[model samples]
Target chain A: MKIAVLGSGNGGCAVAADFALKGHDVYLFDFEEFNENINAIMKNGGIFVDGDFVGFAEIKYAGHDIEKVITGADLIMVVRPAFGTKLFAEAAKGYIQKGQKIVICPGSCGGSLIFKKGLGLELEDESIIVSETSTLPYACRVIAAGKVHIYIKLLGGIYLAAIPSRLTENVLIDLKEVYPGIVPAKNVLQTTLQNGNPVIHPAVTLLNAALVEREKGDFYFYEEGVTPSVGRLMEAVDKERIEIGKKLEIEIIPNPVLGLIQGYMQESNYDTGYSKGRGFKGIKAQSKLDNRYMNEDVGYGLVFMSELGKQIEVETPIMDSIINIASVIMGKEYREMKSRTPETLGLSSYTVDELINVL
Target chain B: MKIAVLGSGNGGCAVAADFALKGHDVYLFDFEEFNENINAIMKNGGIFVDGDFVGFAEIKYAGHDIEKVITGADLIMVVRPAFGTKLFAEAAKGYIQKGQKIVICPGSCGGSLIFKKGLGLELEDESIIVSETSTLPYACRVIAAGKVHIYIKLLGGIYLAAIPSRLTENVLIDLKEVYPGIVPAKNVLQTTLQNGNPVIHPAVTLLNAALVEREKGDFYFYEEGVTPSVGRLMEAVDKERIEIGKKLEIEIIPNPVLGLIQGYMQESNYDTGYSKGRGFKGIKAQSKLDNRYMNEDVGYGLVFMSELGKQIEVETPIMDSIINIASVIMGKEYREMKSRTPETLGLSSYTVDELINVL
Candidate 1:
């Protein structure tokens, strides 16, 4: 199997290394401005992996050229934050060949829809398969140049869904080799609703905003930041997500069970689970309020979810609140921009059933 | 001159003591459950003042009996949180006599309007004059029963407005004796729009949620909690407020200037004022998120402001966001209850101009 990773950030590096270690030819690509990691990988001729996944894995290609990276690749994975999807989509649209699969790892929120729109591809187009997962498979980071640390490789929580819905199985066949635990979703909407990042990141970051600003990333994000009151806010957001999922007829896992499966906590409810959860004990808070937690998760993820609620006529007051707060803190007009919305995706005219069938 | 001060908490005690010190016959009143302070004052034959104003000022009457408290009072002051306005109104309804003036100290947001609704009285009634001030005259707290520590007595900040705009001057003349700095506003809407507590408390409390939970009221709230990011959120809410005021043709002071006038901060902008302000240095953060900051400010103050924006067809995203977050944290459905809204005040049927004229 040949794979191309269209980002050189921590998620991109981890995904590329895992595939290479599994005996697949992996090509890592990034824009020149973010080419430092790929440049180090090129210099070392491989990626250094530590923690859960150990040893070095050789990559066949590492560069800024998108065409060279994806040449003859069987699968291409976009592993950047949701905000970076449009850029990758623009970069890949001209180079992508027929039958090549593009899977967005942790679409964060509505990644596949936004990416497909960026490519100007129709849902019925069968030349290429586009799919998205609920979240990234590994909680990993780049420790240093050419070196990555794998905290926990997700086991049973990740879900994948393809554009046009029917193509989900085709994308899953090849992806299963790299991510054996990955399962097919009913549709992209199902995958998006299962995205717990939108439920967790923004609320936790916002509720702990002062601490984050004061300590400058010195506090344990989950252990010290998420108090009982903070956890309830996240739960309220999760309830809205669950209601939206129900309205769409998707069998969405409630956030606590999903959190447990995704390695966030030992318990199955918000109050006890978030406060006592050891899975997220030592993670440092973001030093700034404008990080990916608010930018991607709230701006992209919650904005899309809240808009979907609007389309389905399901009230999402909590989700809307998170987006509004994120906009103020980040100094962005998210509501006015109608960001990642059904209207932006050109799906505003479709009924919920139509949207599901189209996906 | 006899003055009736309802709801004997810290503010009530302080205001009652201030009037008594000025040689007015003060009748301090509260429910029996909260009579501890008044009972101690009665035992001491007056209130024990400390800090700026020191001495025991005699009170003619101090009890939970509403009828006895207002029997011969020249003025009535409601000094409780905005949430308590209804209880006070209900208690004083039949007991209230024509020509007897009632004023809400720190009306917070729409205090006069909500109180009017609770009394089932129209602005045109003219039987009684109802007015409100932007904030309390002094920043004081009860060190113990009958003992209040006065921090600062506002010099030239408070603004008062009556329900019927024409009645403002008459209400202010008597109020000016006790509150020497009191100035007549254009209307109650102007006073409500000038409210700075609603603009400050909820946003700062929410942004510093974790710190408040962990520190448990140990931190100096304004100096430590109002980071640049948190200040920006309040500014965003303030922008919505200013825009709403403009739509209604009210001369609303921006929150920073209003904060300086009300003595919350020294500077006139959020970034510099909140960080460098000497006025807010020693105020402690609430020990829990369920305090009056969220309950009163967000529930009554921001809720009314946002609903006013809705009625005027102006956008109040930040205000709405704060209310939504507060609802989730406090486990209440604020929007559904239409908490302290224009409709609740029976002004929903009126046009913006009509509502303005009625005020």
Candidate 2:
């Protein structure tokens, strides 16, 4: 099998290296501006994996050329921050071959729809299958250039859904050899709504905006930042997300329950679940408010959910409030930015029945 | 002139002691449940003053009897947290003399209206003048039982308005001897909308909820809590407040500018103005989220502003957001609580014109 990973960041390198070590032909690519990691991979001729998956994995090619990376690959993984989804989609416009599969690792609130629209493909088009997973399968990061560390390879609880729901199983079948625990979701909405970064990150970040700016996030994020009030906020946001899913006729797992299933939590509640979770034991908050927690999670994730709620007539007061507060803190109009919304995802005109039909 | 100061809390003790020092006959009263300070004042025969105003001021009366304090008082000052306004109003219901002048010191968003309604008096009742001040005249606290410490006497920027607009000047004339800088406002709406606590306290407290809970507020609140992002949230809420004022044809001063005029700030910008303000130099945050910052500020201040905005068709999204976020943090629905809303104040059915006319 052949795999092309479309980012050189932590998640991208982890996916590419883990699969390459399993004897798959892998190619790594990032934009020319992010050539540091790509250059390091080229110099090392491979990526070194540690922790959960150990050993060196050889890469067949490493470069900045999107065409060279996407030409004839059987599987293409778009693994990066939510903000980069459209940019990568645009870069892969004319190079995508028919019958190829593209998966947005951890669709941060409608990544598949944004990527599909960015590639100038209609939602119903089936020439190529574009799917998204509810979350990335590994707790990992790039320890150094050309070196990736995997903290925990998720044993289960990853949901994948392709555009035009009928083709979801076919795409899952292609990657089942590496990710046997992945399961099919109801549709792309399930994958998009089930991702919990937007539910947790923005609330914690907004409530702690002052501390992050003052102390540069000196405290342990999960242990100290997720206090009772912070946890209540996350529960409010998660409830809204689940409500939106129910309105769409999908059963979206609660974040804490999902956390328990994914091996990230020792408790089954929002407050102590993440604070005492072994999977997030030592993770510190971002050093600043301009990090992806606000930019991508609130900008792309909450904005999209709020807009969808508006379309479906579900009152998402908490979600809308978080977005408004975050926008003021960041000095950016996230709603107007339209980073990801029903309108941006080409679902603005679709009714509930039509949306269910399409997704 | 005779003056009765209700509430033995920080503001009440300061008001009572300052007036007694000015050769006025001042009586201090509090509920029997809060008799520690009252008993101490009775034992000492007065309140010992320090800081901005230094003296031993004799109190003619100190007890929990509402009639004993309100019997023949020329001026009645309700000085307490917003939550206590109605409770005190209930206590003074039958005891308020016909010719007495009642003022809610620092009307925390429609305190006058709430007091007026609680006293079972019509808005147009002219036998008694019911008014409210935009802010208390001093930044002081109770350092010990029967001892009050004054920080600043507020030489300017205190606004006073009566329920019946024509009586505002009469109340001002009575208060002129002690509060020489007090000015007549357009109405109680101006006074209610102009109080800066709702705009500043909840924003700071909500953003620092985790810190307040974890450290029990061991840091300088304004210096460390009012970072750029926290200041931005306050500015956003302030903008909504000023807009509500504008919709009612009142010119609400921006909080930073008001802070400058009230001698609380050394600068005129939101970010550094309060953080580096001379008046707020060493004031620490409340020791818990359940303090008056959340209860009085959000429950009364922002909720009132938001409900008024809804009545007048002015958008207060930021104010609503802060109220919603604060409600989640405190585990109470502030909006539904209706601590001080247009409806709770008896203005729910009034049109904007009718509201302006009655106020």
Candidate No. with top lDDT: 2
Which stretches in model 1 have alpha-carbon errors above 4 Å?
A65-68, A93-99, A110-123, A336-339, A343-349, B52-69, B89-100, B108-130, B163-167, B311-315, B343-349
Docking class of 2: high
Query: What TM-score does candidate 1 get on C-alpha atoms?
Result: 0.90
Using all chains and alpha carbons, the TM-scores for the candidates as numbered come to 0.90, 0.96
Per-candidate RMSD, Å:
3.2, 2.0
DockQ of prediction 2: 0.81
- Across B64-182, the per-residue lDDT of candidate 1 in tens digits comes to 89999987788999999877888899988888888899898878777887777678887677788888998888878888988988877777678998888798888888887778878
The C-alpha local distance difference test score for the whole of candidate 2 amounts to 0.89
**Model 2 TM-score (2 dp):** 0.96
Per-candidate clashes, comma-separated? 2, 0
DockQ of 1: 0.69
lDDT of 1: 0.84
The positional error of residue B302 in candidate 1, measured at the CA in angstroms, is: 2.6
DockQ of each: 0.69, 0.81
Error of 2 at B103 (Å): 2.0
